[model samples]
Structure formats: C-alpha cells, structure tokens
Target: MEAQHTPDEKIVKIEKTILRGTRPRSIGYNARKGTHGPCITDVVVRLHTDSGAWGIGPANISQEKAKGLLGSKINEIFKLPFGAFGEGIKLDLPLWDLTARILNLPLYRLLGARGKRDVQLYDASIYIDDLNLNDRQAVSLFKEEVYSGIEHGYHNFKIKVGRGSRWMEPKEGIRRDALVVRTVRETSPAGSKIMIDANMGGTLNSTLELIRLCAEYDLYWFEEPFAEDKLLNLALKSHLIDSDSKLLIADGEFHPPNYFFELVEEGLVDVVQHDFSDYGITWWRSTAAKLESWDALCAPHTWGSYIERYHHAHFAASIPNYALLEASPGKMPGIIEDGWEMKNSRLHVPNTPGAGITIEKKIFDQGLDDRSAFSLSI
Candidate 1:
C-alpha cells in the first residue's frame, strides 16, 4: 500500500491492491491425516495509507480458509479509510487487518509506539492436536512441541482443547488439565505466563470446577471453556469466580465479524481471538475501532498460508489494544526465516515492504487456479 494528499495533518493517497493465489492444501494431524480437513486456497492482501509525512494501516483479511465464502471470493477485497490517523485499531480478526497495519506503523509511531522496543509481543498457539495428543500429557506434550518457539523468543502461550471433552470436567478432566499447566510452568521460564483453552469442553458444573482449578495455577487466562450458545451456562459460570484472571478468551468457531460483539457485548470474553483465515481483515478493523476504548486485548487468531501469518505480524505490531499475535510452531517460512531474526522473546519487525518476501512464481502457479477468477487488484 502507498499514498499521496491533505495539508491539514499529512498527505498520502492509497489505492486498493490485490494479492491472489491458490493457498496451500495441507491435511494432517499431530503427525497424522484426517478424513477431510479444511484447506485454504487463496492469499490475503492488506491495505496501507500514508499521511504527507508517513504511511499506516491494518489487514483487510484475518484468517484465510479455503472453504469459506470469502475464500471463494479471493479475486478481491477493500480497506477501511483513515480520515483520522491512529484511530480504531481492532481486537478481532478481519480483512481490514491488512490495511490497518501499514497505516498503524506510522500512527503508532506518532502515538509513541516505536515498535518492538516500545512494546514486547509474543505469539500464542491457538489450536492443538488433541486427537493424537492425549489430554493427560497436554502440557508436557505442548512443551515438547513448542520448545523451538521458546528458543525462538516466544514466552506467551495458548492451548486448544475443544477437540475432545476430556478437558471439560473438574473431577475427570482437571487432573490432566492441571498436569498440562504444571508441566508447561515447570518447563518454562519461571516468569512465563500461560493461557489454557477449553473450546467449550464442559458442562456448567465442569466448567466452573475447571476454572477454579485453573485459578490455582496462577494462569494468565482461560479460553472458551464453555459452549458457544450456552448463554445461561456462561452466566452461571460467570458467578463462580471472584478473581479477575486477566481474561476469559473466546475463540468461538467462525463467528466472523460478529465474533467480538457477541463475546464482548454479552460480557462473555475479556480477550477475543479472530483470525485472517476466518473473518477477513475488514471485520477485524471495524471491530478494533469498536473495541479500542473497552480495554480488551485483541489477539488475532492465525494458522494458514505463510502470507496470512506474515500479514498478522504487522497487525500485532500496529494496533494499540493489540495483546498478542498467533505464532505457528515453525520459524514462520519465507523472509521471516531468511531475513530477520527474533530478538528477546518477540518477532523483530521487518524494515522491508509488503511482507518482506518474494513469492515463488511456481508456488502461485501450482497452488492457485490460473483462471481470471483468481486474479487480484492492487
């Protein structure tokens, strides 16, 4: 994204751009394969705007799933405007996430966020392989797999558990659940913070009990430990705790742009997780604007094509209410692996442009459909 305009503040003009492709198709488990898993077959392009003196913005796509309505419409997308700079960063994932980032760098700079030194960030792992990985070994197993992340400078952690109900009960699931936390805490730096995700894995009784057990571990927060539509259950569960555990996250499956509203307006979540693969960046940006004053830390959910994750880096780097960016187990491929290196416990922001990586023509040719339907704008 580039720009030119306005004398009042700064002048920069931005034009819409498109980056399209057939995304990667991967179907496997904790080392196995499933009957039929979702595959993302398109690329997400973010937007950027500049003031006469600088450039800024967020993503236009959050999570990029090959199975969704947006995925099928990969031929195009647009950005949120910036009549006002540094305003309305989102807490949920959406397409505008891309546009906002390019714009964010400059706005945040003006707002006193000088990038990494000004703020330290760590990526949280959203989903986990529960089928192959046993609940009993959840934490220890998590540690074993993410050791590289620890080594790579990630300290904040998140675990996914909706895959099964083993973690839903206090008497039955708490043992294994506790073990997961114990093992992670034991193996991680003493100061390392932890987040657990239940993905609505329990009954009201079970969720409440599990929450208490989680409280004992000095956890950073718990995510979606109850069912999505269980409003009453969530209400009853809400009354069970007296302490402010920092947050109760909800990564409700594909709630889209309404995800944040449902979670926040209902007083259900303290932290919200949205991905480029799911909501597209437009929704993420609008939600950010709505959520900015609420004091909620929006962590963008991620797991898909390299560019999506690459796009999220700037997303996390740009927003104010931004809490964490989802970091995959691998060193993120492409330029992140080749150009910059992690410093401390966070990803080093790239000084390069548009993801800082050159796409292999073949990857696009082999991964995407060549028809006009797959063509994008810029």
Candidate 2:
C-alpha cells in the first residue's frame, strides 16, 4: 500500500452525523460509575476528498463545521490539535479509509493485517442489576440472560458483578456476587468461558472475598475489580489475587492508550480492553503490537451499532493474541442494513472496501425527522 500522498490529494468536505434514536436499553450496571444509563449515541464521520472519493467511520469526535476541513490535505488535517478539531485521533479512521480506497486497498491491508480472521466474540449481557429482584430473583434473571447467550452460539459470556447499586447492601452484595458466579458456572456449557467485570466498584477486601468464593468455577478472567484511577491498589490487589488463584485479570477499557501501558507495565492486568473508536485504528495497530511484546492479550472493548462492530472485527483480524471480541447484546435496529456476519459465535472479518459499512440512510433520516437523532454541532 502507498504511504505517501500527492500534493493534489486534499480533503474537501467533512460531514458528521449524530445518531440518537436508539431507544434506551438498560445494560448491566457499570460498577465503576455505580449506575447505568441511556444507550450510547453514535457519531458517523465522512471524509470527502478532492478525488470525489469518501471514507466513513464511527468516531467520538464532533464536526459541526465542514468548511474548517475544506481544501486541506488529509494528512495535514490529522496533524492539527484534536481538541481544537472537536475530534480525537480516531478521525484518522475515515482518512485512512479514504486513503486506502484511493489506493484501491482494504483498510486492513493498509494496517498490515491479512484477509478476514475468525474472531471469538462474546455477548456482554448478564448484568446483576435487576432492582426488582432479591438475591434469588437476581440469580434467576442472570441465568436466563446467560442461557439466551448460550443458545445464540456464544462460547464465552461476561456478567457484571460488584453489585455497585445501593439496592443491595454490603453483605447482601457480596452474597449475591458469589451466587451469580456459581449460577453462571452451573448453567454454562462445561468447556465454555465465563468472565466477570467488576467495573472498578469493589473495595480491595470485598473484591478478594468475592473472587475466592467464586474462584472454583474456572473463570476465564476477572475484569476491573477495582476503580481504574487507583493504579497502586489495582496492581497490589491483582498481584495478590493472581498469586492466590490463577484468575487472569482484565481491564484498561476506560484509559487512553498511553495510560493503558501503565496497567501492563505495573502488572495490573492480564488482558487489556481498549476501544479503537476512542484512540483510532493506528493507535490500536501499534498498541496491539506493544501488548504482544509485554506478553499480554488485547481484547478491544466494543459497544455501539453494527458499524462499530465491523471496525472492531477489521482490527481484530490483525492481533495474534486477541482474547475475545465484546458484543453488547443491546443494539439499535436498522442502523446497518447489511455488513459482516456473526456466525457460530465468531465475528467474521468483512472484505468490503473502505470500512465495509453500509449505513441505512433512510432509517437515519427517519431518526433525524423525528428529532430522535442528536446533532453534535461544533
């Protein structure tokens, strides 16, 4: 793939689409914040070049003014300070897509990843926050959710623990934590994998208790058992826990790529779960390579519509020690008319040019007409 661009290759137009009609779906409680809220809105970014070729990507940045990007070379635009641009480095995805398309190559080809690879995908439901339920009722609800995931061919499953909500007191919270893990262990297929995400809600002592109680179930990994900001405590607790029981630790979903490196160097986690949308495709390519050097696994944290999932699959196809791709069971309808396929519990890579996304413009237009779509004007 060509890395250098000609002088005439200038970005002419930049359009940002904010999608918000996705009905609020209550996901598992986020232990780090101690609550869950409305479903996340998505930002679709389109980078149009002078060549009349355009590339689209999902980003966390907002671009309300298109003229700001007018008549500048794509590489020059990416070099501007992200804060002033209303976007992060993630904007590079569209630029990269546009560049790859202009060069007539797939995005993965530019990233040095081969054709599609089978990515082991896990359904991230089974949250333990049924406020209507007592301990028994909560366990029952978790079992139902896990069973549904299993029937859908997911070989691995993740459940929220730490009971971060006030609905369960401290003692009761600890008790229910054990119950939920036990229930998942009993209900899942014998060789299947189970992961627990504490969302950084647990105190070191309480989290230790919870881990010991449920350690016999052969958990694939324990995720963010403590708050992310407490790096010292996280490292101390993770080391103690790993020494006691062989449970692999996973975290770093909320941190930037640089800080995530701290977690790896300090031995705070066994697996790193960073989001490509937050950092960008180039960051992930380099970060995944760095993690491999540290002998760690990369499980890119993903949540959003089908388009975002497609992006994850494309990048995941490159990582050698990719742990598992996260698939949130919650998704808005009709966001993506057609794209990649999820079969036998694996997210197969897409071979389409550019980002391989097919947005249902009509559905998005309906969202706009109904005022359900959010417009992130700069």
Best by lDDT: 2
lDDT digits (tens) for residues 36-125 of candidate 2: 454656667766677788777775443433444556666565531121123325466676667666766555655667434777888776
Clashes of each: 67, 1
lDDT to native, each model:
0.45, 0.66
**What is candidate 2's TM-score against the reference?**
0.82
- Candidate 1's residue-wise lDDT over 305-351, tens digit each? 43555445554555667665655444222222324445556666565
The global Cα lDDT (0 to 1) of model 2 is 0.66
- Look at candidate 1 and tell me the lDDT of residue 97: 31
- Report model 1's TM-score to 2 decimal places: 0.63
Candidate 2 Cα misplacement greater than 4 A, ranges: 1-8, 20-25, 32-40, 64-66, 78-90, 114-116, 151-153, 164-166, 228-244, 255-260, 304-306, 335-339, 367-378
